[model samples]
Target chain A: MTDNQRLYWRATRRLTVGLLLVWFAVSFGAGILFREALDAASIGGAPLGFWMAQQGSIYVFVLLIVIYCTAMTRLERKFGIDQKGSDQ
Target chain B: MSGPLWSWVFVGLTFALYIGIAVWSRAGSTRDFYVAGHDVPPVLNGMATAADWMSAASFLSMAGLIAFLGYGGSVYLMGWTGGYVLLALLLAPYLREFGKFTVPDFVGDRYDSRAARIIAVICALFVSFTYIAGQMKGVGVAFSAFLDVPQNWGIAIGMAIVLVYAVLGGMKGITYTQVAQYVVLIFAYTVPAIFISLAITGQLVPQIGFTSESVLPRLDRLLVELGFTEYTQTTKAKIDVFCITAALMFGTAGLPHVIIRFFTVENAQAARRSAGWALAFIAVLYTTAPAVGAFARINFIDQVNETAIDDLPAWFETWESTGYIDLDDKNGDGVVQYRAGADNEVVPNRDIFVLANPQIAGLPAWVVGLVVAGGMAAALSTAAGLLMVISSAVSHDLMRMTFRPDMTDKQELRWARISAAGAVVAAGLLGIFADNLGFVAQVVAFAFGLAAASLFPVIVLGIFWGRFNKQGAIAAMVTGLVTTFSYIVWFKFVDPDPAGWWLGISPEGIGFAFMWLALAVGVLTAVATPAPPDHIRQLVEDIRIPGAN
Candidate 1:
């Protein structure tokens, strides 16, 4: 593999691993594991944990995907691997 | 107009529009049939993916599930949507770069083994067929309720409609039709939600309305008064919720129909962006779900509790005749007291809440008609996608790749169409027998569990871990498939309870445990076996790079 390809691969792996950890923290951590502890607090007139389980985690998931897309696009450009024919 | 009359009108118009889209987008060749000639725009492909992903379960039954499960329902919400993150970051771009017409094609090439390909085909067919049966039943339920047709006839009619588009237009036709269906289903879902939210909490957005001071606190108070647990409390064991949620997330990413949607887009980058758009479109309905559940529950409680059985509201009386809602005059008392125990006099089917919400709130007849159409749209769109997957698996993977390598493209397309028609007929029969099987939502969960345990591990490991070989993939898939399937059948059918389950986890959540088992077997086998050949390792690197296609 070329130096550029190896660098791009490492960068992509780092980004995916970091983002996945965040996904786990919000969904499994805040949403399920620590839910009762978080429930003692409130958000928008509902318990914080309840909101996270049902609503807040979904919003965060959407945000995470958007971030992944943007960061990947930048990484592709940096490595000169961006598709020239892409609609983006 | 009368309710049935309005329902007929809405249903007829939507069917006509779907058929028209199918006619215009009919497939011309194998490429067009399988992946829409790989020219679909990212955002448009995303909308189609959303429609294909949000099946009848999402449109007709999910909010009802949430209404009944309360905080326990987070499994559906987080599990279904969080898988998109897995798809976008882990699966989509790499799979798109592999440039295949179907998922099994990639498996066959990556593992350099026809046996691995065949196993993948079986897994895809198993998951798609199980999921499609639930969609057919969803169609049946909507038709039986709104159009006053028998459930069997409803399944046949849904089969016929799917046959027309799915056989003729294939993926090309299904894609555009799904885009149109997405618009209809989302509009039909959100409009009634907006009205109910405004009436209940004076908030325009249902997500905000759910947390509004007017909604949750009052519902919690009334629930406590009636001897039920507070609506938002975590009543389910935390471990069970975690297992179910994890299974669903991985299963969603592994689903063949959803993964195939990425194959239709122009490039890997478009695939990534498409995954984002799909989640955004899905979130519109998902986020609104809890609010809809809250509104429906509040309305239902106010209408039934303390009311004399004979003096119940017209909706309750109507639903009672359908056997979905049963009222027992326990202790010979005329008054009905609804609560969460076996001693309660009312048995409310959770599936009824979403379908009956508009009527319970006294919405206009047209809104009810539109919601029915939306439910059918959700069912039919997903059924078409699943049928397409089944057909391609038969014609492409089983026939062309395995049995008849000399077949021409024209012959392959014909086989694809024929297989699609056969699948629709088979799924229709399954729908007819669905009641003997189980509930639509629970049946769909089993499909997810199977996909999670079997396909998810192989696909992720094949891409990320180049050391994963044909032996490891085959061993992991068979072990996962057999373990999960037998456990579900034994508990759900044979014994129905047994002495105890593995660690007391129910069949719906046990697939998550098997998913970990599959991963462990896959990694251990890879470490034991020799590494794959250099060409296969090169293929992995090629897929990892974005523009390699």
Candidate 2:
């Protein structure tokens, strides 16, 4: 791989892996694993973990995708690869 | 107009509108039929994908499941929606960059093996056919309950509507039609939710009402008093919940109908944005659904518990007539009781909660009609989307790629239409005979597990691991299908009990265990075997970036 493409790929991988960890924490972690512990607190009127499991995690999923798109766009611009032509 | 009359009016108008859209968007070429010529806007494609993904199960049955499952129901909420995160970040953009018409196209090319492609075709067909049968049944249920159409006749009508568009317009037609359907089904879901939320908690948004201070505490206490688990408490094994949600998330990301929608967009950039929009559109219903469940449950219990038969609300008899909700008055006190034990005099089927939610809350006649129309929109749009996948799997993947490499585009289009029509007839028969088959819900849910286990691992590894060769791909698919399919049949059909659950994983959750197994097997086999050819590695590298050189 070219150095330029490798740099861009590394940054993209870091971003994806980090965001995926957050996704896991919310849905699988807070939503399921730590749910009982989190239930000691509440959000609005819902038990904290219960809300995360059913409602909060879904909202976060939406946000994470938005962030991924925005961040990827910035990466493309930084790498100067945002043009419309194909390598082939 | 009265309730039934309003139903007729809405169904008539929506059906007319869908048919009109199908006519205008009819596909003239294989590109138009397969991927809408790859010019769809991100937001529009997102909406269409949402409509395709939501299905009759999401629109008609989800809230009812949530109503009963309570806190335990987060598996559907989190598992299904969370998959999109994986799609947007890891899969959709990359697959969109690959610029394929079908998932199997990518598999066949990436692995450079027709055998791999045919296996993918089988996986796609299995999931789509199983999934479509339930949708046709959902269509039938709404038609019979709301429009007074006989069940068989209802399936026939639903099949015909799907056939007109899916066979005629193909992906292009299903796209715009699904966009329209998304609007209808979302309105149908949220309007009733808003009404119930307002009536129950004086809140406009059901999600907020469900979260903010409301009637849930009293509902929980009353449920416990009636010998039930707490409403917001986990009643199932936590591991079962965990595994089921994982399987569903992986399955959703892997679903062919959903994956193919990305190729309808212009580029990978649009694919990412579309995934976001799809989730946002889906969240409209998913976030509101739990609230609908809580509200519907509270309303249902209040209306039935200790109410004398003579004084029972009108909806009681109405729903009872449909056999969705029944009152036996078993104690002979002429009063109905809905408790957890055998003494309970009410059988509130899941359908009654969602399908009957509007009437249960004393909504207007027009609202009931609107909900029925919404249910039909949800059912048919998904049916059409699945039909697209089924037809393309047979025509594009099986016919052109494998058997008839020299086939003309014109012949391919004709065959595509033929396959779609055949699928609609088969799906209709499944729906018409769903009762004797008697496992619609079980089979539809099992599709998720099947997709998760068989297709998800190979596709994900195909993109990320350049060395994932055809041998590894074939091994993964065979292992995933055999393990997941046989395990589900063994547990769900042969001996249905928790005693047989492996490590607290239910049949639906078996996919979670097997997905990881498929991934490991694929990776290990790829390493142990020869690496892929130079071109396949290069294809993988090229798909990772837009302006690769």
Question: What's the TM-score of every candidate structure?
Answer: 0.97, 0.98
Write the residue-wise lDDT of candidate 2 on B152-219 in tens digits. Answer: 89999998888898888999999999999999999999999999999999999888899766666777
lDDT of 1 by residue, B124-228 (tens): 999998899999999998999889999899999999999999998999999999999999999999999999999888899999899898778888898888778
Give TM-score values for chain A, per-prediction. 0.91, 0.92
Candidate 2 TM-score to native: 0.98
Native contacts kept, each candidate: 0.70, 0.76
What tens-digit string does per-residue lDDT give for candidate 2 at A1-88?
7788889989999999999999999999999999999999987778899889999999999999999999999999998776365312
Question: All candidates' lDDT scores?
Answer: 0.90, 0.90
Docking class of 2: medium
Worst 10 residues of 1 chain B by lDDT: B436-445
Top model number, DockQ: 2
* Count of clashes in candidate 2: 0
Residue B88 lDDT, candidate 2, scale 0-100: 94
Show where candidate 1 strays beyond 4 Å.
A85-88, B437-442
